[model samples]
Target chain A: MLERTKKSFLTALWILIITFPLMGLKTVFTGEQAEVGIRADAFYLAGVVFLCGMMWSMKGLIGRGIAFAVPPAKSCTGAIKTSVMKVPVWCWQVGILAMLCAFPFMGSEAELNKYFSFLIETLIYVSLALGLNIMVGMVGLLVLGYAAFFGIGAYTYAILSLNFHVPFWPSLFIGGAIAGVIGILLGIPSIRLRGDYLAIVTLGFGEIVRFVLKNEAAVTGGEQGLPNQHIPGAIAAPSLGFMVLDREIHYYYIAIVIMVLVVFVVHRLNNSRTGRAWIAIREDETAAMSMGINTFRMKILAFAISAFIAGFVGVFYAARMNFVNPEAFRFEYSVLILSMVILGGMGSVPGVILGAVILQVIPWLMRDMMPNLLREYFPSAANVAGTLTDFRLLIFGGIMVIMMIFRPQGIIGNARRKIELGVEEERD
Target chain B: MFQHIVDGTTQGAIYALIALGYTLVYGILGMINFAHGEVYMIGAYIGIISLAVFTATGMTLISLPLCVFVAFLAALFFCAAYGYTIEKTAYRPLRQAHILAPLISAIGMSTFLQNYVMLAHGKDKFDFPGIFRAAFINNTVQISGARVNYLEIFIIAASLVTMLCLHLMIRYTRIGKAMRATAQDKKMAGLVGININRVIPFTFIVGSALAAIAGVMVSMYVGATKFDDGYMAGMKAFTAAVLGGIGNITGTMLGGFILGLAESMGIWLISSDYKDAYSFILLLIVLIVRPRGLLGEQVSDRA
Candidate 1:
């Protein structure tokens, strides 16, 4: 025990040895180029050292607490699965549909606008997460550049509509098709690579897409961005008695309808033979190939299908935003979408939706809704409220780390995925 | 043309230093330390702060080199602690989890650190003190119709010396042998009584320390450091690691130099506006054509 304590202290000593120069010197020495007014404060140095030591000492306790609190993922997910199974599928579906349809009528303009906008954004991310789910969850390909497809879809639609005057409805399919083609192009090379290599390739491809979009100024309008995108209104002539889908509520319904359709299709696909092939590939590629799954074709198919959905969302995204920029599609966005899939429970339809909603809505509530509510009581809250928006990523990263450590299977984790995650497979 | 080479060499040296962190961590753990870049960023911040402290104390009045040495040491120490802490908090928990878990955790660490620093420091670039203000570094020499700054010479020499020391340590040191053994086979190494836990974090410490040195070098060279500086530079170094076949130290060095020269020469040959795209493009091509990279031996089929 004494030896172990010595070792632990030595570790702390090592940390202090490194940290002393970085923090202590900063507080004491100030900086080489600092002006005369600046002076090193002893208090700050003491505080930094104390903090470091505290963190170092508490490390073991924290690790143990986290480890102890985190129950095996299998049990947690099994509980979720059983509870979900108790509810009739059709009843839940109808209930969701009713709630969505009545959402706009629930509140005033300010409230409705906020909820409607939040719902729309959440639904868009759902689609993105669902698309990523096919690759990461179903097929087990870690794509770090999934947002490139999202961008591709948006750009294809923007360029086609802006240049060729393509109609919004047709442009949506065309955009999706173009994205699918790009996916296939990417897939051909990626099929040979596995895991981290595939991730790097996709990441690189994403950067390439962004650079091309940014550099090809004539087509993408460069940094100024392509603006004034055509929004889809009235499925037909307004005189035919159909409502023109120009309002936020109309957009909300349209987005929800699309989301429901995507969920349904993804659910059906999950049960299909192709989905089984994907599962096989995910489980063990070599085994799946030997079993004659045509792993390459399925992988490409997954990529294409995933890209198609992203493209579909991209059209609606462009329409809703009424503008498109290369900046909108970045590598970080891909990570965000990927997080939704992973956090929700990879390879599970309901899991992805839950993940998307939770991740998106939490940030929305923290950054926008919470501040709005808080500022109503405390007028001075406005200044601090704005900074909450800046902390969004910090919170996001913290959640991801905590989630991975505590609940790797996610809130609504798939059983197979739990197994893949190395959670002890509980015999139910 | 020669000036581009000189510039490329300095940039490449820094990239090599950063790449060593990536390669060392990857070699030991079989996981890409995505947050390694953020660790470098923290080092840069520390470098700036330490310089301010030194200047405040009038330490330059004593000896400029001594002052700079203290600042570099400070940055190195803090970054090493950050690196070790990150491993303990974000990585250790997910060591036995699926591959994606650690990667996600790393991404989270990266995002968290970036935002945390942004919040603490405010979202503005800080000016870095130029440590090497001596007559040698202040002057430039004409080489093949191009001006080569003495600072560039210093950067190259510093990078080479660091790499040499690291190579010697890894080859001759007891801890280095243990690290190598654990990297080769963790279970087997443990069976042979090697302390896996200590070895892993130690690897992180050394790798992070190297990154700190690189970070300080970079800030000094550029005369400024920003919150997001780590992301692009990290990506470039990551590219260099992959280009040289990740986990191979010598290959990482070669990859860094090659990437640096390629970017410099490519900009000269073509356009500078898309300079950032060069590394990504090279990474894609390499992964597609030769996943093993220039000097990477066969990575086990598992990863």
Candidate 2:
């Protein structure tokens, strides 16, 4: 009993020592002016310290008591797997297609525009996530600077279209090719490195790309960024007025078609011999190399292909937004895309798409739909919902933390990743 | 050239301070504490408030040096608690989880903290009151056509003192021995009866305290700080850590100084518009030329 008391006492004391100085310092020193006097602020400081001490002690006690409980598995992988396996793939595809095709027709014009915008955004991420999955999910490379390719793709089309009056159709290939070349350049240097080192190196490349884009005013339009990005007018289609790519509906359809094409290619690749080689390298590079696989070429192939897909979507992104800016390609955006791939289930195509849609669509729905509903039923609550929108990123960060902790395998756990993560757990 | 060197040294000191935090944490845990930057950010905010408290209490009652010491200590204390809690909440549970889990958690914590600070302190930049506004600090000493401010001298001196103290502690202390043992091998350390849990959090506390000192000095040096200041500073410091060979304390210090000088000189040679790019380019160069870093021992693939 005495020992426990002594331990708790020590814990509280340590907490007190650490908490008082930093917390009190802030209240005492306002930046420009002294707002609250020291004597007045002393109580607040003391209260905070006491609270911290109490919390620390409680944690010590409660945490010990709870330590014996078996931890729940991080994700409902088994449950999801069983349910997903029960559904036939064709039914799932046809039903999804039917719903997507009928989406715009069901909503009011204003609602249709909003829904189309969301769908277009979703499609863009779906393509981006799928591309990233090739490197991160299949190749097992954590590419931290993925948005650099996205940036490259956008900038390529923007520069080509704006400068030479090149149309969007050809620019897409050019942008993808440019990004693919850059990806190879990055991948070659990174081939020697693994894990976090490669992650940082790629991150550095991404930043360099951003800086160059921001600095080269002559070509990239400097910080003002390339505005009024030109995309080709849509081709005439049966039963549709001259489909203008700038219009939301036409762009949405084009994006959907591209997204489908990407998914198909990715699915085909995931089942091919090359895909197996990539996964083998991901599992053990040395083993893969020893097995007569050219690990270097395959790794670079993953980078090139992934970057191509990113670049492909980049042209579409520029067209959809009708604007291209350095801000669109920040490190944060890369992390967000990576998070989508991770949360959905790394290496799972359907999982990543599900992850992207859930992350991207839910926030908008919460911000736009929730407040309107609340404002009608409970007017006062609407103001609270409005303020909650500001915390979207905060919630995203929380989700990332929670998801990683609870279910590192993600929403749709791949068989390989599940085994790997499981092996990791038993080692400790 | 002399001016750039002096500026670089001051900048280098801050980077060294931040780099040490990364190195210490990395040494103990293979995971990168991505939220370390946000911890520094929190420290700076706390430093601002602590300064306000000290000023409100009236500095006339005590010597200026004592008042300054008190303010720094206060900031360090609170930042230590923050570091402790951060590890407890974000990292501790993931200790045995997948490798990527901790990294993702750290990123999430960073994102959360950045936005949290933004909500607490408005998005705009806040002017950090120049407590050293006295002639002693503002006065410039010219040496060989180079103008050096006394504040720069103070910054360098404080950084050196902190680093020296850390060096002494790590070299001689029992806790330091335990930390080294644990870092060398956690399971073996546990077998040797060393408390891994305690050592880990203690390492966090010490790293955080160092970061807090850096945060205060930086806010004072720059004259203004924004909520987003930590991101750039953290990345540069992380670069320094990697350049020096991650987990090598001495290497981190040397790396920080070299990076600072390179950045300063690079900005002078090229346009300052690409100032952020300079460090990243240097990082890439270092990565390609010598992946292990200058002082880093060869670390084979753990797999």
Per-residue CA lDDT of model 2 for B88-189, tens digit only, reads 978998887656678878988999878877765569886666654453467899988998988899889999999999998888999999998988888999
lDDT of 1 by residue, A1-428 (tens): 45555655565565445444333342322233464342243335345555566676678988888768895756888999899889997988899889888877778867678677788988889888998999999999999898999898888877776677666677778878999999999999868786777888888899999999889887787877785343443122112145445567767877887788788879888989999899998888889999999988899999999999998889878766667889999998998898888888888888888888888987887788878877888778887787778878788888889888987767677866556557653210
How much of the real interface does each model capture, measured as fnat?
0.65, 0.60
Q: Clashes per prediction?
A: 15, 16
Candidate 2, position A218, lDDT: 86
Question: Chain A of candidate 1: what's the TM-score?
Answer: 0.79
Per-model TM-score versus the true fold: 0.89, 0.89
RMSD of 1: 5.0
Expressed as tens digits, the lDDT of each residue in A1-428 for candidate 2 is 46655665565565545444332224423443465422323345345555665666578777766654634433456678788889998889889988887887887767688677778888899999999999999999988899999999988887776667777787789989999998998898877887777888888889999999988888888888875333343211112334434677878888889899899999999989999899898778889999999998999999999999999899878766667889899998898888888888888998999989888976776677776677889987876887778777777787778878787767777766566556533434
Residue A264's lDDT within candidate 1 is: 81
Query: How well does chain A score by TM in each candidate?
Result: 0.79, 0.80
Give stretches of model 2 more than 4 Å off. Answer: A1-33, A37-84, A228-242, A417-428
